[model samples]
Target: MRSLVLVGHGSHLNGDSAGAVYYYAELVRQQGIFAEVIEGYWKEEPSLRQVLKTSASTEVTVIPMFISEGYFTETVIPRELGLGHQGPVPEGGIARVIGGRTVRYTLPYGVHPKMQDVILARAREVLPDLDRPEVGRDTTLVVLGHGTTRNENSNKVIERNAAALRERGIFAEVHALYLDEDPKVGTWPERVGAKNVVIVPFFASEGWHTQETIPAELGLTGTATLFTDTPSGPQTVYYTKPVGTHPMIAEVILQLAAEASQARGGDLDRTHAESWRLLTRLAHGGLRVGEVLISPYSGLLELRHMLDEGRPTTDLLTYVTPEGLRDRVRQDDAGEYRPVRTFRTLPRGWRAVVDEADLRRALHYIYPAVVEETRAYTCHSLRATPWPTTARRQTGIYAKVQKASSAQVEAVAQKVCAACLRTRLWAAEPLGQTFFDGVPGGIPCAEACTYLVAAVRDELSAEKSPEKQDQAKLEQA
Candidate 1:
């Protein structure tokens, strides 16, 4: 027999959290898709671990009813169910043999393309009188999610869904607001700028956040239509039940289960593949630079020169091992020099030696605007300090850059570039730059100059591109 387990992040404070989980479990059970359809939770009864232990089926599928891939779905759920390491269940699928039973894990349902249909259906329920064509012109749809400071990954799917809805022009405007993050629920009146506002909670169930906190924050007496005054004018705000409570969600769960069962063993391995792929044509052919490879065993960073195919040279071929950088050197075939394969341990640093050409290529590849703007800037000005380190330290820099006015972005860019110069990260020669004389005391670990260029470029890219913003939201979520 096969079993299906619907796992939810149950609430300890209220019974609402697990309501939809149990509802869907029973709904699927009635379809007779599996011998048993059970519901499990992190905080409530029939805990994940307990349910898995007592299941009678030899095979089981655990589908997380989450809006995005985050801590709970990636860690707690997998650990409790004994599904591989306590981290992201592979993207393709996850099947593990544990305690004589096979468990297949599927990705969160929120990312599925069909989910937009469900969201649209939920919003339409609140605006029954509004025609399909008039929906976009008259109503503003707001997707309210329980954003978290702990894991930005929690809100990716919600933001993606919101972006998709906006692109479709199905509403006057589509805005994604968070309970714990930015675009606060209280400011919806002015932020939405629409007389008719429809809010749909992007939660798996009607928990405390959806049922109590959201209502209080929005100044709602109940789920019924309420009139509120905003900076613009008076507006009508309509709230609906959580998206997960919709009956159509049962079909989504079954679809996810079917997908996992089909991809069971073969593609699951491919799902755990690396996120970044460095193609040979791009690295060696187009870029004409060294190839960056990862060590299979230790996952260490290795830089191999394209010119020296067989022979390793100290020129640029180096690997960052656990201890330090291993600079590979090629010796003569004769007895005069050391053996052909020899490596010397270099001091631990970001790069063995910064390559100007490589840095330019990387910057242009990652952020073309950065390269175009800084064309006159010499490599010396750009090479002094670590750009990657500085960029990482400045969290949310992309949003800061994006939100800034046209004048503000330029002014801020000048200030940032000047600061980099003062810190010795940027050069002062070409522009008669007399910003700062010496480097700052607490300079971070120096990485390849190209990496720093790439980092800054990425921020600029994010600022200029809306699609990049959506992608960033997905990543951050």
Candidate 2:
């Protein structure tokens, strides 16, 4: 079957790091163009290396939902897929035989010319006729990036997009600015030669750069500052959210994946089969993944959400479609955003069931690839990352968690992970904690999660603070 794995640079500290990817991936999944649509992240769960381990597609395309072509698009993503560029490169990207399967890797999603459409859409949200030369003559459009020397063409995308936008004559001036290098975004006041400025951040998601750093650099109070005081008299500043958030980008992904698929040489026979057909085999019998219970009785396959296996489905909210099920699981009973879907607080008394053909779509809406991965783990074909290695790979604010003593990790997991349903398989490995190899009939967590690591970092920082230590002593006394 055909499947697509969209990789993005997720954040350990911000749950919204991959929001755009997840949101659009779900949209694409609903379209059913690809048998399976899954997400892999460089900084989150279901890592890039193992994303395809449980997938059923023999012919798959790996597309990075990144806005630039550099270290990530050129090297990191391919290496994670074990491509190593050993074979001849194809039109879309490098076509490599990975895990004995021919997998096509597409270049980063940002290089296409169609991306200009999404940026223009974002601009229209503030100024309806921004595309018209009459209305855009006095406006300056800034295409921003974290420009670098990592690759010779590192700044090509932003520069190229900027040049293309300028050619459209939609704005008086278009400047490609970077945060990490010269002609930086912070120096826009002096670099951009226009009174009316509009900055469109070339990022895949809203996180540190889009939400914090960019706003700080531009001195924007909100999305639009009308006639604000600036170096060149009072000029209006309009800041559009990252283009990835625009609805049109999801359509962009569809075109890119379709293009890559056409370039791959594969046995088309049975390639169009639903990727979730694997779930149909177990439809006759019940299978459990963590707290989700899948049962077949009375000629109906029922997938229920509950805290305990002993609980009944009485008074539970029932949903029959994947979309409805996802909406329910994205939040806890308290109506707070439940970023980690496997948390023990998984709103109890909820049920979802679709035909056997759509079982994977429903299950993946909540648990992702957990069911298939669990089966692989049971068959001894899957291995969990050791706790130390899992901790060491954390980046950004969570990287400090690597310094956490084993005892500290144990204590933090006991508190933070105590409310999650995911079996901490890492806990059973070397240098691990007390013991939780996970019981049968539960989803296995191959590595530590952001939720647990954040808690560990907090506790470690608290212990390091003399004031917090004094307060702890006071409480104990």
Using TM-score as the measure, the top candidate is 2
Cα lDDT tens digits, model 2, 318-405, are 7878878877776677877665666776776788767775676677767666665565565555577776876765655677988888
Q: How many residue pairs clash in each candidate at the backbone level? A: 10, 0
- Which regions of candidate 2 deviate over 4 angstroms? 11-15, 43-45, 70-92, 130-133, 146-156, 168-170, 178-196, 206-238, 262-282, 285-287, 297-300, 306-314, 336-341, 388-463, 467-477
Q: Write candidate 1's Cα lDDT for 31-84 as tens digits.
A: 987766666776553455445543445677889888788777887688767676
Candidate 1 ranges beyond 4 A from true positions: 10-17, 224-228, 263-477
- TM-score against truth, every candidate: 0.52, 0.76
Q: Residue 459 deviation, candidate 2, in Å?
A: 5.2
- RMSD per candidate (Å) reads 23.1, 5.5
TM-score of model number 1: 0.52
- In angstroms, give how far residue 22 of model 2 lies from its true place: 2.6
lDDT of 2 at 267: 46
